[model samples]
Target: MSFVIRNIDKVIVGDGKVLSNADIYVKDGKVSAIGAGLTVPENVEVRYGSGFCAMPGLWDTHCHVQSSGGIWGVDKDMLPEAKAIRAAAQAEPVVLSGTTTLADAGCDGNISFALRDTIAAGIVRGPRLLICGYMIRMTGGRAGKDTEGEVDGPDSARKATRKMIAKGVDFIKLGATGAVSSPGMKQWSPQLTLEEITAACEEAHKAGLKVHSHAYGDEGINLSIRGGADVVVHGITLNDENLQLMKDRSIQLLATLSTYKAKLPYLDKLPRWQAVKHIQVCELLEANFKRAVKAGIDVVAGTDSGMTFNYFGRSSRELDYMVEMGMTPAQAIKTATISAARSFGLDHETGSLAAGKAADILLVRGDPLADIGVLGKAGGVAQVFVAGRLVAAFDECGKEIG
Candidate 1:
């Protein structure tokens, strides 16, 4: 499992530095060297990198890996075997699209955990997965009481956090506010009380795990910040005070802008209530995201893929929306690379093209800095490698070749 990509035209270091005419050497599942004119190792495969731009593989921090149903939501009664099969199949396209790592925001049962383990065991070909077993929510809150995440009071929340930790979750997801995808849930109203949210955060932090709070409105955002949330997912309405607090606490924002934007094309097909909320959120997202950028908030790119029309394999489209909102192409790319890894405490292992880091890299055909949309365009991704192993390769027409 060793190879050298020789004579790359350009190399995006994934930390705002792009080197020209460089070579990347990967051995034993880690990057060994990244510079020009490196000595070739004996018996290692050498791949020509001419006309290719090598970069760190992308990351998507917010996704539902086990669910794929549209606006009506995933069928709760679906058989577990069927769910596992469908979920594994759905993840293949994501890695093929150049995303090397992704986080499952929430999932039912043990599907996501099973998927993550199987991928690690090489039972399946997919991106590196980080998952929260189930999102903690108030009774009658988002996703309803029938779900496993229903918790009320501080003690209940703490217990729920422990349960998820016992289940081997990577992080804890708290539903601080209602969501647009949930019918009858008001997006502006906070769902989990400050005490409840704080309890979950405290328990999770004690276990050395970060907490991602699903919040949109100002009230929910403030509650989450005060509750010690490490990251705010879909933080759409950040006021001046909340923005300042986030800056002071170094709280990162995972803006799932592509979630709502992806639904625009099928607005007519959605229920009126959901469609209206999507439209309103889209408008608010652009303005608020611009404000977040200006306020110097660390914004990470995440697509709520598997939600409605926000399909997998198009996760890079979130970076496109980020560039359109306010970021430069390079900045947007960093959001999905270095910034994302830092938010999730994976920077030391992956995220950038550097020696001693995992050899998770993507080879694209063109310069994404010149046109950010190239990431989302067909045939843009040339090859994808995870841990120095070639997982996927695409033809010129965006067809999977390996």
Candidate 2:
């Protein structure tokens, strides 16, 4: 399919640049050209972009699509088929919210892989999915009861990494610290040792896959950095040394801020231990985030969606938090666009509006450059295209339209 978005008010190039009053020509599921007065074939469809702001589709680096029911309601015992169905149901809302690419942080069994493959095969309507089949953790680590990748020593961790690769995972998710959701575990309790983490990272790197380490405390964060993790997820208790190590290693931070922020209104509904941990983390999040930014760390946007009150389709709110913490509107947008693509090694294909890139484009009603919050507002996203195909279109009232 081929089409052209004519007279776009502005094109956010996703790399801190914008093209004004340009025409975007898309053909064969990729951007053909981006310039004024671009001519197209007679059979191509042309859509008016006069009222819309064009930009690269958003990216969510940390998401759990298979886990739905929130905190107390999350049932780890759900049948595999049921989990897959629920995940499939959640994909549309995510794509419609302007996210064209996302990484499934972890999933039960092989549900994430199935969802990703089905989407690739056109059997499902969703964004591009990169998934880690199950998060590797210590035997008694966080969420051990929910996932199957629990290991103990370096050998065990190496074997677990190989198992995930055999399962055809896109990346390896390592649990370096305990989590807030686990009732018996303290959030700061370091779980995986440096040796174990190194084993897993080495195995994953050898297979040409990135390692995303789930860490919260200083010890875990430092261990992950020393272990050669490609990206550190959460990173709540970052110290100066950790920051220096991360900078020296070129490791990006995927701060899932929305998850902590989303828990505020529902603190009363959470378990006492969980609520306390959430509050503590929320208190430190902004200060630590600002510090990381000031220290010149590369930050990526992720909402930890599908967890507690952090629902899907609200992923763009992470950008608002980023701007509020320190980043400018353009910098925050880059974190979710070009920066995110670079993190996933997808910069060569889709991150921005270029002459030869996947047409993963988002059209919004207002200028996101002036107000980053507009991207999170209702009825803000007017259209969403993935691989040059219009998968979602919303009316002025935020209702889905043909």
* Per-candidate TM-score against the hidden true structure: 0.96, 0.96
lDDT of 2 by residue, 1-402 (tens): 889999999999887779899999999999999988898999989999999999999999889988773775566667889989888888888898999998998777778999999999989988999998889999878643564799989999999999999989888999899998777888898999999999999999899888999998999999999998989999998999999998888899999989888889999999898899999899899999999988888998888888887788778999998988879999899889887887776788989899899999999999999999889888899999999999899888889999
lDDT tens digits, residues 1-402, model 1?
788999999999987788999999999999999999899768989998999899999999999877784666446677877888888998888898889999999887788999999999999889999999989999888753256888989999999999999988989999999899888877878999999999999999999889999998999999999999999999988999999999999999999988888898999988888898888798788889999999999889899998887788778999888887778999999999998998777888899999999999999999998988877777898999998989988888888785
Stretches off by above 4 angstroms in model 2 are 144-147
Q: Determine which window of 10 residues in candidate 2 has minimal summed lDDT.
A: 68-77
Candidate 1 residue spans exceeding 4 A from truth? 74-76
Instruction: For each candidate in turn, give its C-alpha RMSD to the true structure in angstroms.
Output: 1.5, 1.5
Candidate 1 backbone clash number: 0
Model 2: how far residue 400 lies from native, Å: 1.4
